[model samples]
Target chain A: MKARIRITLKNGVLDPQGKAIQNALGSLGFAGVSDVRQGKYIEIDLAATDEAAARAEVDRMCRELLANTVIEDYAFELAKP
Target chain B: MKTSVIVFPGTNRERDVADVLAAVTGSPAQIVWHGDSEVPQSDLIVLPGGFSFGDYLRCGAMAAHSPIMRDVVAKAKAGVPVLGICNGFQILCETGLLPGILQRNASLKFICKDVWLKVENTQTQYTRRYNQGEVARMICAHGDGNYFADPSTLDRLEGDGRVVFRYCDPKGNVTAEANANGAQRNIAGIADPTGRILGMMPHPENAAEPMLGSVDGRKLFESLLAA
Candidate 1:
């Protein structure tokens, strides 16, 4: 099984890095860019065969270490062969 | 008074803090490694500033989960004074000892300079030596010091008077221009309800000596020692 996670800053959180990227894009002639928010994508491979167990553990990982819930939100999906 | 300083990988300010701690306590401060599982009983536990874990996966994220933090968290809950400076502040937030997160500076650049801070709360274990509204000069060197919390949390911190320090002008005015990092409410430091855990972005240890520029930072250590 594999877990694909996407972590991002929560709505209304100020993201200076993302804002700088947006401004740079605007300066590079990329118009109509109203906003830019940055995030992280992580892919993990699990040896566990049970899909439910894998998901539950991944969720714990996100909450415990992967994502700081104070200012970030995280979502993930599991893929099993 | 005894003090223990935790050193994580890439931690660079532990010695500076130790210098101040040893001087104030009249004993050598213990150096605890991040991999250690136990924290010795002490009057104070310090998490000094540094680029912990190279700021990978967000500042202090990895360091917050190090083996030693488990014990550090337990001691903090038991009412030991834990001071987190700069990178230590980020780790405290990540560990949920302190509310909120430290994001990149508003300018998206590393900031290194002296800033005036108004003593917002003088009743805590960390700032009792200073008079209320006293302006202290401290060194702040980091790229991610912009503090952020939800609106309700901000209100609660304000209502509870947990804000220990705020960036201010020389005359003690907290103007927007005085906010160097765009921290919410210009917060430079805060304390938990028990007033034992304190996390601040400025480097007080660096300013502990007059030769190093300013002596305003030593008062914080003195306060901790007396408490």
Candidate 2:
């Protein structure tokens, strides 16, 4: 099985990089760009037997290494090959 | 008193901190490599600042997983004094020894210069030499020094007085002007709930000698040595 994890800075947390990009886009003549929030997409391959097991393993990976729970939020789902 | 400074690849300030430990405390600190699993038995363990592992993935992320950190974490949990500065502070966060995360500066630029920090709580073993509210001059050099924590965690830290230091002006006033990194509530340093482990983004070791322009940072060592 394969899993895709999306890690994002939690809401209400300041995202400096995203803010910078938003500002740059505004200065470059791109109007209507209200905001830019950045997040990471990570994919992992696993040999889990079922979707439930794959989801659990992916959550473990996020908690252990992929996401810092203090300021970041993460969610994942197992995808069919 | 014996001391040891953890040395990781790409740590630019290990020697600087070691020099301060030697000159101010009159005790030469050993340089412990990151590859070593065991830290030498010593009175103090310092995780000095620098772009450890070139700040790859995250600041201090790789170094936090270094072999010696397990020993450092063990000793810290056992009540030994451990000081983490700059990238060291980031390592502590990664190791779960500290409560907050270091984010990029609000200005989106690397800040390098002398900054003032006020001692917010002095009841810890690491800060007994200074009175609460005394402002000390230290230097901060990093791209990621802004500290962030969830509101509940911040409230807990504030309620327990774990916040040990705040950025300040030279005259001892806490002001936004002195907050180079825009840390929440201007926090510059914090202690573990037990107060034995300290992680701060400021570089006190850099200012520990008069030749380096200030000796204000030496008080931290003096306090620990006396204790």
Candidate 3:
């Protein structure tokens, strides 16, 4: 099984890196960019054969380590091979 | 007094903190590596500054889950005095020992300079040596030191007097211009609800020596020794 996770700063959280990218895009003549929010994408391969078990395991991984619930939100999908 | 300084990969400030601790406590601190499962008994447990785990996957994220942190977290919950400085502060937050997160600097730059921090709370073991409202000069060198927390949590910290340090001017004024990293409430440091755990972004260990430009931070060590 494989887990694909996406993590991002929670709403109302300031993201200076994302803001810098937006400003750079404007300077490069890319207009109408009102906002830019940065996030992370992670993939984890697992040997578990059970779909439900992989989902639960990956969910725990996200909550425990992959995402800090304090300022970031995370979501993930599991696919069985 | 005895201290234990946790050493993680990419941790560059262990010696700086250890030297200060020894100077104050009159005993050398035990250095514990990240892969170890237990931390030796000590009066104080310190997580010094540096780019732990190279600050990858967010600052302190990798270091927080190390084998030794399990014991560190257990010790902190047991009411041990835990001090996290700079990158160490980020680790405490990641470990859920402290609240809030350190975002990138508002200016999107690594700020390496001296800043004034007012001692907002002196009731803890960490700040007993300083008088209330006293401002001390410390160094902050990091790309991400902007502190953030939800409004309710911020209000609670303020209400309970857990905010130990705040960025301020030389005259002890906490104005927006004095906030170099745009931390919420200009909070440079905070203690846990129990006041046993303290996490701060400023490098007090670096400022402990006279040759480092300011000895204002020695008070923290003095406070600990007296506690």
> What is the full ranking by TM-score, best candidate first?
1, 3, 2
Give RMSD to native, each candidate: 0.9, 1.7, 1.0
lDDT (tens digit, per residue) of candidate 1 on B16-110? 99999999889999999999999999889999999999999989999999999999999999888999999999999999999999999999989
Cα lDDT computed for each candidate against the true fold: 0.94, 0.89, 0.93
What digit string (tens of lDDT, one per residue) describes model 2 on residues A1-81? Answer: 888889999989999899999999999999999889998898888988688877777888888777888888998878787
Question: Pick by lDDT: which candidate is best?
Answer: 1
Candidate 3, residue B112: the lDDT equals 96
What is candidate 1's lDDT per residue for A25-76, written digit by digit as tens?
9999999999999999999999999988898999999999999898899999
Q: What share of the true interface contacts does each candidate keep?
A: 0.87, 0.67, 0.80
For model 3, how does the per-residue alpha-carbon lDDT over B1-227 read when each residue is reduced to its tens digit? Answer: 87999999999999999999989988999999999999999889999999999999889999999999999999998878999999999999999899888988999899999999999999899888999999999999988899999999999999999999999999999999999799999999999987889999999998999999999999998898775
Cα deviation of B111 in candidate 3 (Å)? Answer: 1.0
Candidate 2 lDDT over residue span B1-227, tens digit each: 88999999989888888887887678789999999999989888999999999997678888988889999999999877899999999999999999889998999899989999899999887789998899899888999999999889999999999999999899888888988799998999999988888999988888887788887788887888776
Q: Comparing candidate 1 with candidate 2, which one achieves the higher lDDT?
A: 1
Candidate 2 chain B lowest-lDDT run of ten = B18-27
| Better-scoring candidate (lDDT), 1 or 3 | 1
Interface DockQ per candidate = 0.86, 0.72, 0.82
Error of 2 at B92 (Å): 0.8
* Worst 10 contiguous positions by lDDT, candidate 1 chain B: B218-227
